[model samples]
Target: MVALAKEKQKELVEAEKYVSEVYEAIKERNPHEVEFIQAVKEIFDSLVPVLAKHPKYIEHNILERIVDPERFISFRVSWVDDQGKVQVNRGYRVQFNSAIGPYKGGLRFHPSVTPSIIKFLGFEQIFKNSLTGQSIGGAKGGSDFDPKGKSDGEIMRFSQSFMAELGKYIGPDVDVPAGDIGVGAREIGYMFGQYKKMKGAYEAGVLTGKGVSFGGSLARTEATGYGLVYFVDEMLKHKGLSFKDQTVVVSGSGNVSIYAIEKAHELGATVVACSDSNGYIYDKEGIDLDTVKRLKEENSLRISEYVEEHPHAEYKEGCSEIWSIPCDIALPCATQNEIGEPSAKLLVANGVKAVGEGANMPSTLEAIDTFLENDVLFGPAKAANAGGVAVSSFEMAQNSSRVSWTFEEVDAKLKETMASIFTNSIKEAEEHGVPGNLVIGANIAGFKKVADAMIDQGVI
Candidate 1:
């Protein structure tokens, strides 16, 4: 026992030094790119022991090359609003890696979109896609175009103009883009229409997240949320517990959160709260999914409107306060860095049994560290929230074969994929002598697969 402990300590020391060196170089090269730097640091910090085992990675400078994007495209997107005024937005697509396959990720259209943010998301996508063990690479694209308060015609025009430029770089088997924060069915429809117009071909595989009327997959809408619940179920089941009669608090009212609540209810768990950027809605009787869907999807109103229908429900002003509600499980389905040290401590104190991220990098480093130290069953975003992309791969396959799978078939596949991912992550963690460390386990497992592929491909 003493020798094993001493050897583990030495491994950690060597790992830390290697990680610090790589992190310093990344920080120096990418000045003022805080989000990108943070992301690179987090993954690098987790990869020390993995790197030490693979000397060829160091010889080829794979760490540095992987940190840099293979190709980044930036262009001007100009469209006319309903009032006949010309508006311009900056667009970007960062093809992070293509070793495993073509570029595959989502296109997010939010006001916060920037090069640093896109690069950070793209970098994370590389591992997220790799964890699925599918033939897909990592890429992310979007524009700083907020769709809120825009008329339907205005949005369609903006999407068309954006795709007019984006279509040139993307194709069915080259790079396929899906939807994220602000890019949903409506946006995808417009973009697909524009792509077809430009290419003069029906390339349904060029995009995911399409509505069911076209070549879209049936379970695409519910995949991410359902998959998250499925992953959490696997984790709890490992410890001989289930979501039966337990309370759950899920952040965000978007598609991921709503369907997660739906799946939780289907699995016999009572969901108590969900939130938006403005505030959160809490109903100890459990939130009504119909009302949430109506307010957010139908009316496009804030979550505060949910209180009007359910008078007993409370509407809080701050979105982060939702973490204060005691629950058996907490799922951050919202944006990046939503949970920091304070929220992590609060959730731990409130007895959150597990945390599964539905959104990318929803928890800060401090929060993740705290969860690890406290022995909380924390699921990293790369492994936990990969269901959406996994299903997207299914969609691509369906389109390629000119077939549409039934909803049951797709849902079953998604559940199996999520379970496989959870099992693999645990297997990797245990083998690396860091049982229960999903973050490290996911990083190492995904990195090794990509690294070996990159090496075999001869350092392109």
Candidate 2:
């Protein structure tokens, strides 16, 4: 195993040297774009065998072209607050890649939203969408607008203004945006209303994550979390384990983490920890799903409030410390790069059997390597958290067909989609002789499809 690992390391070094020119050029072209650079490095390091298999990709300059977004848009979103105060925020959209189908991704509305973060997310989306067996391409848009503590009117106004400029660039067949982080059903509704008002057409397919009363599909809210559990379940079953009676640690209290907790509990896994921006709560008896939902989803409170209801639970002051708690499974559902080498080491020391990323690139490269070296089952974000986007595509189909399927139907389809994703990732990994390494399997599998599609299209 040591010899094989050393050989793989040598291959990665050679791969880096092979792409050094283009990688360096990307850095010089886009200075200080750390997140985007990190994302590119991860996938580029995994493509040595791929480039060897398909020389046309390199000859056609697919890597260079794919690294640069087809289009980038930025604008100022101006709105009026409930107190009659004028406010302004920056909005950005990165139509990153569109080799397979129309651009599809999410719109995040948080203060941390930046062009670098959006570009990284958009880049990851390209491969993630590819792995889903869906025809959606990749794009991402968002704003530096913090919706926390804002009144419904304030959020609505902000959403309307954000969409006023964004609507011109997106359409049902062009780019479809869904919810991320701070953006949810409420924000999607406002944006959809603005898009309709601006375009003067009721194109429900233009945006997803809408209310079921309109065009939204059922189980969309639960897709990412549930999909993650489903994918991890596949990994566990392969390793002769299961979620039953397992202790889990889930970071974040957003829609993804909340439903992830619900599903993990349903599968008989005790989710012991969940966090938010302010801090994290550790419940020894397993988190009370109702208390968490009431505090986060219903009341929009910090995760620290979880300790108020559960006296036996403990609330840590910072979210970064949540990784120190012992658990069998660690699900990082928070933001990007939340788990670094330190956190990964802590989880490994505590005998974590698996790590499933519920957020985009939640684990750093070093952290992922640590987990892999320790024989931990690692489910990368592009494959695990794809449930939401899969369902978004389903919602798009429902909109196009002018029909809504029952919740059972949508949910059953989502389950199958997630299972198919797992099967494809595992199959591709084994076929490429990187058995059990879904990172390489997923990247290669997704890249082959898009690269072939791009080559066949004759260099647009």
Candidate 3:
């Protein structure tokens, strides 16, 4: 069996040679492009069976069309600082795939923003959005201007300048970018305000993750985190267990982790740890969500601050070690590759039964393998963290209909969508003779949808 699996892997690699060539060409243009190439290649390699199953996809050269972005926009954003100094930054919007519908994703704002990262994210978004059963396509855009420690005026100016150029490419029926990472409600508001100013119209659907009064969905802030929990709940149900008495350890004290902890606690789970970039706080007795929220949301303090308020809690200087602590379930919501092989081994050894990703690609490939080998109920990011984009699609629907869905209505829809995604992923994995390998299942399931669309569209 091992030999046959190795042979199949080799065949898959060989079949992807042409797609690899395109990625190599991009890499030659810029060495930094390798990251994006590797990310896309991983998905492509797992999808070889789909190509074999549907010869029409190969006949139509769908791989080429899938990798190539439908549209790309680049522009310079010049904003003035409080000192009247003009700061110029480069911005990009990659509308990766829209065979399903208009491009949809998030706008990230950080110094780490680059074409490679955006492309990788956009590629992942394609699968993530598809799993939601929504009609939206995949796209991602952002600027390399970091908002951290920046004055309000500077952020406003940067956002306005960024939107002045971005507004030309985005619309209610075209590309829609929501908040991601550094981009949040404040940045969305600033960009939306500028977009409205330039277009001379109020287009609320132009961007998602908006403030509640500005047509944002009620659970938008909590969607990704809550969705992570929802996916885990379904996974546990298969094992005849639930979050009712489980203990969860989540990394990252940001939006996703905060809300995930909240939802886990609300569902009768004890959340023992939450981390930030610097470090994590562990309270075996269970974390104080209110205190954590105040420190993060109001004071904007590091997660270590929770230790001062809670005498029983301990703070660590490193975020990666959060997985070392024992828990019934683990959710890595910090950043890509934050959880690796060592972490995965630790969690499994500690008897962790499930892991639901709340961040995009948070687990390394080795980590994913470790989980699968241990028979851990794993939720791949594409299906697990899709709640954010799923709700964004709901917001788009409300905008098009000139109506707003009640909080209850939207939340119900999100729950149903997440449950369906898990069911589909499981069915696909089982059909492929890898019933527990959700990584491959998610890629194959998502690729089949887009591949079929490409064939139907006549090789566009």
Q: Write the per-residue lDDT of candidate 3 for residues 1-460, one digit (tens) a residue.
A: 9998887777556556655665566567557675577677668767666655555666777776788788878889998999999889999999999888899999989888889888889989898888899888999989899888899899999999999889889898888999998899999999999999998999988999998888888889888988888988988997798999898999998889998999899899999999888989999999999998999888888888888888789999988889999999999998888888998999999999999999988888888889988889999899999988999889888887878888889889999999999888888878766776778788888888877887778755
Provide the lDDT at 311 for model 3: 78
Off by over 4 Å in 1: 1-15
Judge candidate 3 at residue 117 and give its lDDT. Answer: 85
Q: Estimate, for each residue in 1-460, the C-alpha lDDT of model 1 and write its tens digit.
A: 9998887777667666766877898889889888898788788877876766665677676787788899999999999998999999999999999999999999999999999999999999999999998989999999999999899999999999999999999998899999999999999999999999998989999999998889999999899999999999999998888999999999999999999999999999999999999999889999899999998888889999998899999999988899999999999999999999999999999999999999999999999999989888999999999999999999999999999999999999999999988988888888877888889888888888888888889967
Which pairs of residues clash in candidate 3, taking residues 3 or more apart in a chain or in different chains? Answer: none
Q: What is the lDDT of residue 385 in candidate 2?
A: 96
Clash pairs (backbone) in predicted model 1: none
lDDT of 2 by residue, 187-238 (tens): 9999999999999999999999999999999999999999999999988998
lDDT of 2: 0.91
Residue-level lDDT for 160 in candidate 3: 93
TM-score winner, 2 or 3: 2
**Candidate 1: residue 87 lDDT (0-100):** 97
Candidate whose TM-score is highest: 1
lDDT of 1 at 236: 93
**Ten-residue region with minimum lDDT total, candidate 3:** 49-58
